[model samples]
Target chain A: MSILAVGTVAFDSIETPFGTAPRVLGGSASYLTLAARYFCPDVRLVGVVGRDFPDDYVQRFRDSGIDLRGLETDESGDTFHWKGRYHYDLNERDTLDTQLNVLVDFEPTLPEDYRSSQIVCLGNLDPAVQRHVLDQVDDPEYVLCDTMNYWIEHTPDSLRETLQRVDCLVINDSEARELANEPNLVQAADIIRDMGPETLIIKKGEHGALLFNGDTVFSAPAYPLEAIEDPTGAGDTFAGGLAGHLAQVGRYGADDLRRGIIYGSAMASFVVERFGPERLYHLNRELIVERARAFRELAAIPKLAPLQAA
Target chain B: MSILAVGTVAFDSIETPFGTAPRVLGGSASYLTLAARYFCPDVRLVGVVGRDFPDDYVQRFRDSGIDLRGLETDESGDTFHWKGRYHYDLNERDTLDTQLNVLVDFEPTLPEDYRSSQIVCLGNLDPAVQRHVLDQVDDPEYVLCDTMNYWIEHTPDSLRETLQRVDCLVINDSEARELANEPNLVQAADIIRDMGPETLIIKKGEHGALLFNGDTVFSAPAYPLEAIEDPTGAGDTFAGGLAGHLAQVGRYGADDLRRGIIYGSAMASFVVERFGPERLYHLNRELIVERARAFRELAAIPKLAPLQAA
Candidate 1:
């Protein structure tokens, strides 16, 4: 099965309490493509970038079996750029700058070959653009969408409309509560489920992620890391791993979804270990699996006697 | 096997985003006794109260098989009282008032019969009180102590001295970081293990708890609840269940510690579902076992084929 990932493919400068790096090739598509390439070799990448973005970085995707036919080159403008710094508590960060060069006016167009992909990943983007990508897909099996607080605050109706077309929704804990207007996360998942998607995964960063499917719910903690070099692209990498693993399995069950989360978490662990996509870009299958095992072990509490009923 | 819980037995008025409860029976010892009473029938309570404290409230402990012989009544002063309000986020609260009546000159004296208890739970209290309680234990097999930032910030040396005497230390994530002076939690656990305790459990409130032993680390997420009436005694209840389970099994190993965390999480689940200790007071073994099962189920992620190691 093939996967289609649509989002920004640009540059980022990020700093944390640990350290800082400047002007790195980092964006949703860049991180997603590298992570998803580990599970599925044939991943279709669709995003606009400026001419100045390194050819070596673009060539790296091609080398990793990611089809770059949908990668648009805007010769007139520099690539989209973002700079941010994390606080002592890595869970939150402050955006230092944002330069939406080519990204300001670019319209996404899926290649004919990518139109038949089975799994679609709509990374954080305007609701209108996300819908347009879905409109081009010819009956994809699973369409997972990731959005931020920006879209939720500005385009509630457009976001809700896009939610109706996706099978999975990946959002952070606060955004979930804000979108559903419910303080309780469980209630928020319920409200979001009612709005559309059959599954909702609430990413709580360091706390981990929660999965909700009807009354059934599952939670897995993130593989706790010691030093978080950079947090940029972690979420998109997570979504990529989830979609990639599910596409490989062809069926998404409780167990499969749980494993998918582990995969997503493992991918994210590497994403934060280095600035931009440095660590994830060089991540091999062996390391990914090792991290996955570490997560399983870290969260592996021994089973005690079962609880008696109320 | 019996458990000894040493801490405060006071009153509190709590207000949350959901509702408010005025002048409820609360305190570390009160919550610990109720929580420990679930696993081991014998829980020796050692604390001080005042003349205004009612009889029925004390009777609740007597009915739960708690030895209240060490509970001193100060006729000259009023009971210690606290008032606090939680924001929409239950994890944080603003302190409204703190009236240390009997607690001002409080001196805990372990009953003659209490010194021989096999399990010791040193609930959050003044470092001096915690140290006094430690002196009373007669070669206890398991001594677990809980502390907050109050002591960590004020009496660093006394806290360190008390920490060295305990086998397991239970503290919040921030306190753990603060105590070790390490920014990274993983590294903080390492420094803490070097300080004294054989194992460390970092409580992250709703995020969950992390247990770090010599080379093994286990994590358990807080069971997702629909409503959190009051978080006043959740941590004490958690410690109670942990020490209580250890006393019941008469064993404390890496595996047992892992199971202990799960049991603790289960007991805490009951604490927040109602006001003060009302929910936990009526808890039975069957009910606890059911919640323990739910914790196991909630943490169950489908096992994946081991990732290929690099």
Candidate 2:
């Protein structure tokens, strides 16, 4: 099975209480490609970069089995660049700069060969762009979409329209609540599910993530860590691991969704452990499996005696 | 096994997005007694009340097999009363009124029978009063305590002094962070464990709860609910179920602690489903067991791969 992910592939500068890393090879695609490489080796990435983007970074993805036929490099402008710094909690951060260079005019065009990928991950991007990717995919079994509050607040109609076409919707807790106009998360998720999508995942940074489907809800807590070097691409890393692992399995049920959350959580733990995408870039299958087991044990406790009604 | 709980018995008026309830039975004792009834038929409660308190309300506890002999009534004054309103999310609330009648002069005195109980719960109260309860217990194997930022800020010395005597500490996430002066919760729990308690449960309200012991950490997310009528007494209910079940088992290992959290989470789910203690009042063994099973399902999800060291 092949996984196709389309999102920003650019540069980032990050600062944490530990220190600052200026101009790192970072972006949604970079982090996602690295994190997913351990689970699914063959990942096809589609996004736009610029002449300023290093060839070494592109080569790294190629080495990790990330197909870049759909990647566009424009010599006219720089790559999309983001600069952010972590707050004391590491969960909250301040964005110092955002330069939409090649991304300013990016209109993702999927390669002909990528049209048959089994899994599609539409990372945070314009709703129109998300729709365009979906249009190009032919009978993909799973389509997961990630969006921000900016789209919800600015282009709600287009966002809602795009939401109807996806199997899964990934969003932050606040964004979910804001979009639903309901403060209660459960109700907010219900609203999102009703709009479309069989599954909804509300990320809560260090607090954890919640999955909602129909009347069923599954929650996985974030692996508590002592220090977070950078949180720049943690969410994208989580999305990539989830989509990639699910593609590897080639099936997803209630149980599969649960397992995907654990894999995503374990992947996220490494993403925050270091600046940029360094830690995830070197993650091996053995390490992910080990962390997943710990998460299962941490999440699993025996049920003794009588249970509350089923 | 019998459970001994020391806390205030007060009335509360609550308003939520769901609706409003006027002057409902509330406070730590009210919720604790109802939840503990599931595990043990005979639990002793120590607190103060006043002339305004209804006889039927007091009788309710007595009928539930609670030993209310330690409840001292002051006919000249009124029962403790508080009024608050919850936001739509039920995460935040604004206190509208607080009339600490008999509670203002509360001095917990354990009944003769209560002194022999093996389980002790020290609910939110003055640091001095919490310490007094500890002094009264003969030899409690599992003594759990819950406190708030109010006491931590006002009586740092007394709070620190009381911390030395308990086996487990239950506190809100913010309170734990504030007490330890650590921005990260995992680190905060570590700092707290050194203060005395062998176990620490940091309550994150709707986000669920976390248990930390030196090198071990277990996290549980709350069961997402669409309708939350009232959140009053949810924490006390959680504590009651946890302590009651643990006392029944007569164990305090890591697994036992994890199970206790599940029990607590189940009880809390019920507490928020109705106004005040009405839902908990009529709960049966089967109903409790049913909810417990639901907690397991709500929290249970499969994770891909096994955990291995990096």
Best by TM-score: 1
Give the per-residue lDDT of model 2 (tens digit) for B1-310. Answer: 6788888888999999888898888889778878887787668888898999998998888778788887889887999999999876778999999999889888867777677878888889997998898788888888899999998789988998989988999998999999999988888988888888989999888888999965788887787877788889999999998987887788898888888888888889988999998888777777777777777887786645443221
Candidate 1: residue pairs that collide: A307-B289, A307-B290, A308-B289, A308-B290
Query: iRMS of every model, one decimal?
Result: 3.7, 4.5
After aligning candidate 1 to the native by TM-score, how far in Å is the CA of A238 from where it should be? 1.0
Q: Point out the worst 10-residue segment of candidate 2 chain B by lDDT.
A: B301-310
| Segments in model 2 whose C-alpha atoms lie over 4 Å from true places | A307-310, B303-310
Report lDDT (CA) for all predictions: 0.86, 0.85
Q: Show model 1 residue runs off by greater than 4 Å.
A: A306-310, B306-310
Q: What is the TM-score (0 to 1) of chain A in model 1? A: 0.96
Put down candidate 2 lDDT per residue, A1-310, tens digits, no spaces: 8888889997888888889998898877777777776777678888999989887888888877788898899889999998888887776788899999989888877889999988888889999998998899998899988999899999999998999999999899999999899888888888888889889999998888888866688888888888777877889988987887787677878777778888888899988888888896687878788787778777776866763321
For each candidate, the DockQ is 0.55, 0.50
Every candidate's TM-score, chain A alone: 0.96, 0.96
